[model samples]
Target: MVQNPARRTALADAAIEVLAREGARGLTFRAVDVQAGVPKGTASNYFSNRDHLLDQTARYIHERLTPDPVMIAELLRAPRDRDLVKALVRDIFRRISEDRAGYVALLELRLEATRRPELRARLTEAVRDELDANVAYHLGQGLPGDRETVVVLYLAMTGLILEQLTLPEVLGTDGLTALIDAIVERIVPAA
Candidate 1:
């Protein structure tokens, strides 16, 4: 197996694009190599098997989706109020919107996971950990709202991102930012 971290990341990212564009059925080593502009079998060199490739792709998506610490720090400096929650939610939405491919690939992974118990378990654990980490971060940072609030926000944002990506028409233009504001204003307690 290849020992290059950069090469592995490239293959994983290419796999993400393949998944987003072609779904699980189309994610082959050759397809990843083509997408990554690498020689044939390059993906196979980095990943032992299809499941291994899928697992690494999932990890890469999570790594890309995590918020930047500098951005988080900048946002955290704001008042710990519902407004802060709104800002954070907005940032989350922005990140997802910017990385549409990664988010879409993640959705594909979710679908693929339904047919593979091992993948399902891994995704479940990863998502739960992310949720817990967000909750912990919120509490540790003195942010308004509790675990319930974060959970609700997570669900709401997930739905919003899904709709926005798959069918923007479902959420008319007027209801976009206004809707986010409403969610935070109602769920996040004013401090």
Candidate 2:
């Protein structure tokens, strides 16, 4: 099948909107078609099934979340250890804030993928790759117990964001940053 990049892009964008607004349960071919301003047949033509469409959407979101080479270089080149952690935390918070909808959609995808083996494998692999990369980056910089530290920090950050999202009054941005800072302090130690 000839790949129409424009149509694929349109479908993926529409899928994000639908997933964000109505969640995984509300995703449908007709809804995507309406959201994308394309016919249902056209949307289906690009993604033959719901699974195919959702898988593509997951890939799209993962690509967006993965840090690029320039971002990696900037993180690696930061002047101080604290600065490195701060930069990483700041970037995560920025992404979470700027694309709350997308993140929420990703959460939905994770939940849905539990029932679909292929999707579960793909999402799991992507997440593992992300975590491994983070661990390797810190280890390369001589951070202590880098793999375990990254796992702990990553979990803490994700948990904090989830709490902040669900209970904004209790976990404000400043409080979240403080929590992140405390975690980083424990992991990186003072020089």
Candidate 3:
């Protein structure tokens, strides 16, 4: 209900940090206020309730994680082939690694969503939209993959990211890159 966009975004961003550091249980309005360095009750003013805060924070994280259009355009200038697909997927992992907190908070939201139907519905919708967009982009670019290929890569990347985040020692840096290359090589047909 707050009309101040910047202030609302700041509150939502703070809520993400709280969710990342403290999990969903620790993401209270007061926690967000402290994280944002704002007056007490400031978060409460911006978010009608905890659900509202979580919803906005989820959206904010997605927006933050979106690749820059300029970067995407630059990548597109290269030939659309298996190598390009690997590069694109590699860029995705790089972005996720760069925003480790955002991804962790997203995982927390997934756990919270399992217990909250409304949040689950919203996340489901968001996930579906992202999947659809990826399929569309891959097809439109004439990339070496169909929808199913893209879907498989999505699942593979999801698993890789999960392992990288929770068990970094399992994959390490070199293993991660090797796995990405292997997935792309096996999944995307050679052009």
Which regions of candidate 1 deviate over 4 angstroms? none
lDDT of each: 0.91, 0.78, 0.92
Number of clashes in every candidate structure? 0, 0, 0
Best by lDDT: 3
Candidate 2 lDDT score relative to the true structure = 0.78
Q: Estimate, for each residue in 1-191, the C-alpha lDDT of model 1 and write its tens digit.
A: 77999888888889999999999989999999999999998889999999999998998899999999999989988888888888889999989989999999999999999999999999999999999999999998888889998999889889989999888888866767779999898888887
In candidate 1, which residue pairs get closer than 3 Å at backbone N, Cα or C atoms, i.e. clash? none
- After superposition, the stretches of candidate 3 with alpha carbons farther than 4 Å from their true spots are none
Worst 10 residues of 1 by lDDT: 169-178
Per-residue alpha-carbon lDDT of model 2 for 60-161, expressed as tens digits?
877666566788677767654665776777678777767776777788898888888998998899889888988887777765455776798888888877
Model 3 poorest 10 in a row by lDDT? 170-179
- Over 11-126, each residue of candidate 3 has an lDDT whose tens digit, in order, gives 88898899999999999999999999999999999889889889989999999899989998999899999999998999999999999989999999999999999999999999
Q: Cα miss at 138, model 1 (Å)?
A: 0.8
Candidate 2 vs candidate 3, TM-score winner: 3
**Each model's TM-score, in the order given?**
0.97, 0.86, 0.97
